[model samples]
Target: MPNTPPSPRRRGTARTDALLQVTLELAAEVGYAGLSIEAIARRAEVGKHTIYRRWPSKAALLMDALHRVWTTDLDHRDTGDVHHDLREQFVRSAAALSEPPIGPVYRAVIAEAQSDPALRAALDERFLHTVEQRTLDRIALGQRTGELRADMDLTFATEILCGGLYYRHLLTTRPVDETAIDNLLDMFMRAYATDPPPPDRG
Candidate 1:
């Protein structure tokens, strides 16, 4: 007698999801250097072949997981006020970086990239480039819209705005907090000072 059931491919997909979730969870618990595909397979409760079938290499699998939560899109938004928009972006960006699971993952990835050529290349080309481009674009936009001083060097501005948060986070081991956001906004606005004069229609 024939039995009613889903196909083998559907079952495989279900197993893949379980493996990915378990992989991310394990990555959070243990640093990337300590991760094991075998352990992931066991924790996921799927066959080892299942994990291998989806992601042939550990780095590829890990990168895939990272991409899902940390988006690469960071287009600058012109909110009519550069300082206000930048402040808002800092708060949101800092919060994202501070997510419990994500924070540790970033630490581990950065360390690994320093030693691993493949991972370093991937990080620079795929992730870091996107972040830097977004930062540069925001500063340039501020100047173009007359919100920043025409003489301000945007390359230095982007570094000054975001680099401070990174260093402070490293020192304090605290997520970039509201005070950091406020300080960045205040410092940049004061430095840039391009308040548009009230216009008259005669």
Candidate 2:
């Protein structure tokens, strides 16, 4: 049987993936400060216009590349134990934020966002908002299931949970290690668990 040639759509998708992969490689090698569309084009063996047609700027290209490499779902799982689910998700995220490709690319985008209002807004809309909402959904599930205090302010709770990790990951030299994750979860459970911990027996 004769083989069929790939459709233009398939070819286009393959090209897009190849471009994104090259973007990630360059971003990792040069860091965001040194990464540029021209560099990407040169490395990918494509015209600069090809990349610009797909992505308006370096920030947008890097963001897509980061998403491609960081494929872990940002949503928390329904393990019936919200704490466990949150911890599981956070551990995964913390590792990504601490490690290569995703970590460095993400950090670069974030650093650039600090000075680019449009990039900041895109970052919030595409990444931060999705993470925050997924987290809040998990917490809301806990409340509905009677695992968490219904009266707790979920917005603030979500911020504390997500913000603390990012703060340590981005702002401080401290690693978002197991100890930090456990402490954060402990504090959150203490503040929001429906059943308070037993009185100290020590």
TM-scores for candidates 1 onward, in order: 0.65, 0.78
Q: Model 1: per-residue lDDT, tens digit, 1-202?
A: 5887968999866666566667778899988898888888788777778668767666667765665455532345667667777777777677767675567877787789878988777665656555666777877876776667889988778878867787777667665789878977788787886766323222
User: Which regions in candidate 1 have their CA more than 4 angstroms from the true location?
Assistant: 1-26, 35-68, 72-76, 114-121, 173-175, 195-202
Evaluate model 2: give its TM-score. 0.78
Score each candidate by Cα lDDT.
Answer: 0.71, 0.83
Error of 1 at 140 (Å): 2.0
Q: List clashing residue pairs in candidate 1.
A: none
TM-score of model 1 vs. true structure:
0.65
For residue 141, what is the lDDT in candidate 2? 88
Note each model's CA RMSD in angstroms: 6.6, 5.3
